[model samples]
Target: MEMKSAVAALAALAHEGRLNAFRLLVRAGRPGLPAGELARRLNVPPNTLSGNLTILSHAGLVEGRRAGKSVIYSARYGDMTRLLQFLMEDCCAGSSDICAPLRDVALACACEETEPS
Candidate 1:
């Protein structure tokens, strides 16, 4: 990802509500979660959750799709991977051990290919 895009994604995640919402969506996996459900789980007001989702969508961190009467939101795994790659592009100052733990955590949370948006 370009530096600008990475910055945008990072900025979007910098907020408490947005970050929590993004993580919840990530854990929800490919099936995702409806916007109403998300708000309920997060204990956030509908309008507040909508705003957070909007920022996340603009940052390419999350995507939403219409499913009948509701919108389901899912994490954009590819964009997330690219952002992680960007952050770790210059890691450990050439010391693998220093970055090994981070790699382990990332591997633990890695997902298969995501459905196209």
Candidate 2:
């Protein structure tokens, strides 16, 4: 990802509500939740969640598709992975141990993705 896109994605996730919403979508996997369901899960008003989702969408961290009356929101995994790669591109600093935790996180996420939800 470009520096500008990475910055925009980071800025969007900087907000508490937006971050929470993004995390929820990420955990939800491919079958993302609807806007109303997201608000219900987060215990926030629908409009509030909608606003946060807009920010996430603009940042390329999330995408929504119209499903009848509801818009189903899902995290853009490719974009998210690219952003992480951008942040970690210069990592390690000559210490392999320094990047071990990141590897662990990726492993955990991979495991989670494999299991049935």
| Highest lDDT against the true fold, candidate | 1
- Give candidate 2's error at residue 91 in angstroms: 0.4
Kindly list the per-residue Cα lDDT of model 2 for residues 22-73, writing each as its tens digit: 9999989888899998999999999899899999999999999999999999
* lDDT tens digits, residue span 1-117, model 1: 898999999999999999999999988998899999999999999999999999999999999999999999999988988898899999999899999999898778667755444
Model 1 misplaced regions, further than 4 Å? 113-117
Which ten contiguous residues of candidate 2 have the minimum total lDDT?
Answer: 108-117
User: Residue 15 deviation, candidate 2, in Å?
Assistant: 0.6
Score each candidate by Cα lDDT: 0.91, 0.90
| TM-score of every candidate relative to the true structure | 0.92, 0.92
